[model samples]
Target: MAAPYRSREGLSTRPGAYGGSSDEIQLRIDPMHGDFDEEVSGLRKQVRKLRDVAQEIETEAKFQNDFLNQLMEKVLMPTALRNELPD
Candidate 1:
């Protein structure tokens, strides 16, 4: 036979339940007034900073690629071409 079900105020009757007093469980239903605004502002600032950093990195990468290509064309290719010329 199964045990009968019981209902207690602010208490759980399930097996392996947290056996603490109801006062330990605190519930908050407050509205997000100022904290939400502050959090959104902080997130926007961080996103802007990250975007600026990404742009800088992209610019630096493009400059480095161009410099490397110029070096190959002006220095390495001429040397290679001279070696291929008839003596």
Candidate 2:
């Protein structure tokens, strides 16, 4: 059987291998960093879509409020004037 591998000062035994544990840690974390960046971009797009929807809804509500106010003014003005006139 081959000799059991021993790590000296957390270094890999293979020749030409660099910075054992720290290199391994970087290898593991690189892919996760890419995935995290992708997820953040996706979330930003979703937030932008939600913001656009909110703006559209706000604009429509304002238009409806203005329309209702104009309708009330048209309907009530003649009645108010007639009530003020004598019989």
Candidate 3:
């Protein structure tokens, strides 16, 4: 069986002398310290930096692969066929 929900005006519940609810009475409270906006901004900056680095790495890898493919076709193919020709 569920207990009935009561509004603040209808209920007699009050914080103790220390100004905390009974459920939270036993726990020691810490002061709030974090700036949410600054933390989010820092994370956004890190993400942008990582995204830029990843894009640079991807572009370099693609260029290297294409260059290697062209070098192989232009240099190795003729040399290999020359070596394999009947002489």
Best by TM-score: 2
Candidate 2: which pairs clash? none
Q: lDDT tens string, model 1, 1-87?
A: 122222222222333337643323221223543455654575577669979999999999999999999988998888999999999
Q: For each candidate, what TM-score against the reference?
A: 0.57, 0.60, 0.57
Off by over 4 Å in 1: 1-34
- The C-alpha RMSD in Å for every predicted model, in order, reads 17.8, 19.8, 19.0
1 versus 3: better lDDT goes to: 3
- Alpha-carbon local distance difference test for all models: 0.59, 0.61, 0.61
Candidate 2 local Cα displacement, residue 1, angstroms? 61
In lDDT terms, how accurate is model 2? 0.61
Instruction: Give per-residue lDDT, candidate 3, residue 18.
Output: 80
* 1 against 2, candidate with superior TM-score: 2
Q: Which stretches of candidate 3 lie over 4 Å from their true place?
A: 1-31
